[model samples]
Target: MAWWAWLLVQSVVWCSAGVVAVLWWLWVTKPHVDIPGPPTLPIIGNALDFLEHPVTVNKIRDFHRQYGDLLRFYAGPKLVVLAAHPDDIQHVMVTSKIVERDPLTTSAMRSFVGDGLLTLNGSRWKTHRKLINPTFHSELHGNFLEAFHEGSLYLSELLATDSAGGAAPADVHAAAFSSAMRSFCIASIGVDPDRLIPDISKHEVSAVMRRIIVLMQTMMVRPWRRSLSLLRLSSEGRAILMYYAHLRKSVDEVIALRSAATEEGPAKMRRRLLETLVKPGGQTAIPLSEVQDELMTMAVTATDTTAMLMSYTLALLALHPDWQDAARRELKDVFGEGGDYLRSPSLAELASLRVLESIIKETLRLFPVVPMLPRILTEDIRLSGGRVLVPKGTILYVAPFLTHRLPQFFPDPLKFDPSRFLEGRSGEEHPCSYLPFGLGSRNCVGSQYARLEIKVFLATVLRRFRFLPHSRWEDLENSVLSITLHTFKPIEVYCVPLQESGL
Candidate 1:
C-alpha cells in the first residue's frame, strides 16, 4: 500500500469528472439549431438578441424571413424552433413523434396554471378533455351565452353613459374594456369577481390583472432560470421569476376559497367556470382540483385575452364602419324589435350573420388573442425536407401573428377587410393557417365560450352605440406578443349612441 498510489487514483477520478462536466455544459449551453442567426455569446446564449425586441413574434418573423419558416433561438439554456408555415405547424401539433410541448414549457404552465387540461399531455389531456367536454354540453353553452349577453348589456349601459352629451371620444380600453371584460369573465365562470375575491375593489382586480401580465412577461423573457432555479435565485435577465412564486401563492388562495364555498351547492358557487366543470359529472362527480386549475387558468386567461380582443375588435370596427352597419342591419333583420341577445342562435343563424363573423375573423387575424403557443418534440423527426434531430425535448413555437399576416394567405396583409372570412372557404386558402384558438385535439376548451362572448358583446355594443376612434387610434396597435397579443397603448374612441341606446 502506498500513499502516492491512492493520490494518483484520486487525481485520475477528478480529471474524468471535469471532462464529463465540460461536455455536459457544452451540450446544455450550446445553440443546437443549424438555422442561421446573428451568432451568439458564451454563457448567456442568444437571449440578448431575442430580448432586443419586446415582441417575440417580430424576432421570429425576422428569422423566418431570413431562414424561412423555421429558425432556431436559445433563451438561457433552452433551445426553441420557430415555425409558422401551416404544414410545419401541422406536424408539430399533429405529432410526428419529434415535437410536442417541451418539459420546460409544461413546467412553466404547470407551475403557473396547475394541472388544468391545458398543461396535461397524452392520456391525461385526452381524459380530461373527455370529461370536461360534456361540461360545455348540456345546454351550458346557452346558459353561458345568456350570461355573456347580460355582461354585454351591462357594458353597453356603461358606454351609453360615456356618450353623455356626446363626448367626442372616450378611452374604452382604460374605461370600458377592463371592467366589461372582468364582468364577462365573472359571468362566464358564473361568479361575480367583485364579491367573491377577498378585495372587492375594481382597482384591486386591475392591479392583479397587471401582475398577471407582468408574470407572463417574466415567463417569456426569463423563460429558463437555470441552475439558480433550485435556490430560486433571480438571474440577470429573469424578469420577476420571484413574482410568479407570489402569483402562484395568490392562485392557491383563490383555489382554497373555491374549495370551501362548494359545500353549499349551486347557489354558493362563486365561479360559473366551476358550474361548467361540475355540471357535466352531475350525479357521477368529478375532480375539484382539476376544475380549480381550469378555473384559475380561465380567470387569468379570460380577463386578459378577452380584454385584448374587445379592444382590438373595437378599433377594427371603428376603422370599418361599413361592417358595423352591415352587422346591425343583419341583427335587425334576424332578431327584430324583441329578439333576445342572450339566446344561442342556431348554426344557420350564426351562419347568416356572415358579415359579423367576418369582422370577428378579421379582428382575430390582425391581432391574434395569443400570438403563439410553444410545442415540444416528443421524438426525433423530419420536416420540410430536412431530418433534424428533434430529440425528446425541443420547443417548437407556432406564431398565428405571422401566419395570419402571410401575403399568400391574405392579400395586402396589413389591410382591414371583413370580406376575407365572408368568402368562407370558397377560394379561401389554408385551413390551418389562421388558428387563434389553437387547433387539433388540444384546442382551447373555452373557445366556444370565448366566441359566444365576443358575439354577444358585439351584438350588445353595436346594437346600442357606434365606436368612433379618437386621435389615439393610430397609437393603439398590438405590437407585443406575450401571453396574449395586446396593444401597448390604450385605445380611446368616441361613444356614439344609436337609437337603441335610449339617448
Candidate 2:
C-alpha cells in the first residue's frame, strides 16, 4: 500500500476507536433512575426536539399526554423534567421544600433584573419577599387606584383616536402595553409617566424592554453564546448591553432622586413601592443593585403580562358581545351611568363586578402569560406517581398552560365560557388546576395588584367604549413565546364609543 493510503487508514481506525470509548463511558455513567421520555441521540440528546417545537406549547402538551405527567427530556446536556399533572405541579411549586430557581432561566434573567425577587432563590428570595410583601398590600395598591384609572382613560383616548372614533381598527396590544406600562410606572415606580426623562421616554423604555425580552427568549432557546466574553461581542449581545444600559441609567436616576429626597425628611416622602425599598433603616438597607433588580422584575412582570391579559380579555369579550353587554350592565349598575368609575372603587363595589372578574379569570386560564414555570431540583424527586426517581440537578417545569387545559379540570377545555369561573359554578378542581398567577410560596407577589389593575382598566374602557371585532381578531391566539407570551401578529379591534354604538 502507498504511504498516503496507509496514513489515512490509520486515522480512520483511531477515530472509530475514540467514538466507541466515549459511548462506553456514557453508558456506564448514565443516571440509574428510569424515567419515560423521547429517545435521545448521544451528545445532542433532545435538543433537536426542542428546536422542532421552539415556541409551540402544544407540542409540550402532547408530550405530557404521551409521557403521563412527567417527561424526562434533555436540553443539550441538561436533564429537564416536565411536570404537567396537578399533583406534580402542586409538589414542585408549593409542596417541594426546595424552591431554588432553575439557573438556566434565572441566570439569563439576572442580567436584566439582578438579584430581585424574581431571580433570587433560597434565603435571598425569602428575604426579598418579606421586604417587598408589604409594598403590595391593599393600602399601597389602593393608592395606585387613581393611577390605574388615569392609565386606562389614557388608553381609551388613544384607542378612540387611532380608530377615528371606531371608523377603523386600532391595535389594542400596543394601546394595552402603553396603558399597563404607564400604570406600572405610576403604581410601582411611583413616577409620573410624562416626567420620565426624555432620554428614556416611555416609548424608548418600552423599546428597550421589548428588546430585552426578545433577546432573552432567543438566548434561552439557542444558547450558543458560551461565555460573557463571547456574548458581549455578538450583535444581540451588544444591543442588549446598550438597551440594558439605557434601562439601568433610567432606574439609577430614579433611585438617586428618591435617595436624596429620602435624606431630606422621612415624613415628607410619600411611600410608594420604589420608596419603600430605598428607605433607610431596616434589617438590611437593600443595596441599590438589589433594588434595581426588583424594580426591573416589577417592571417586566407588571407591564407585558398585564397588557397581555387586558388585550386577550378584551378580544374575548369582543368575540362574545353578550358577555361584553353583561360586563357593561354590571358596570352601569355599579357606577350608575358613569360618574368617575375611573376613580377607585370601594371594596364592596369591586366585589359586585363578578362577571368582569370571571371573564378575566377565564382569559388568564386560556392564555397564561407565564406559560412555563421552571425550577431546579435541589434534591432528587419522585415522579410519575412515585413510579420513577428523578435525579438531582434536573430542571423541573410546571406548565400552567397544560394544567389549565386538562379536561379533568376544565370541562370543554377549549370553550371560552366565562361562566365556568363564576363562584360556586366551578366544580371541584385540582388546587393547582387554574394557576394564572402560579401557586404557593413563590406565587406571583403582585397577583392581586395585577388583578386590580386589569379590573380597573376593563371597567374604565368598557364603560366608555364597546369593543367590536376587527379584521385581526381571528388570529388573536397566534402568539409567540417571549419571556411572556406575545401575539405573533398585532391585534386590532374596533373601539366604538358607547354612545355611538347605542350600547
Q: Which candidate is the best by lDDT?
A: 2
Runs off by more than 4 Å, candidate 2:
1-28, 52-54, 197-211, 226-243, 262-270, 280-284, 338-344, 471-474, 500-502
TM-score of 1: 0.78
TM-score of each predicted structure versus truth: 0.78, 0.87
Query: Model-by-model lDDT, in order?
Result: 0.63, 0.74
Residue-level lDDT of model 1, residues 222-265, one tens digit each, is: 65532225434434223334434444554455445555553535
- Measured with C-alpha atoms, the lDDT of residue 342 in candidate 1 is 30
In candidate 2, the residue pairs with backbone N, CA or C atoms under 3 Å apart (3 or more residues apart, or in different chains) clash, namely none
lDDT of 2 at 445: 90
Tens-digit per-residue lDDT, 1-503, candidate 2: 99999999999999999987886576556664576889887766777776652365556666777887667887655678877788878766766655677877876777668788878988888888987887788767667787788788888887888889889987776677778877877887777876653343334444445556666666676666424455577775665576567656767777776766625344632466776787533222577678877877887688778877877887888888999999988887887754455455665677789999999888888889888787888888776677777788888878777778788788888888889978643655777788888777788898888888888888878877888887344466665655676665556688888762235
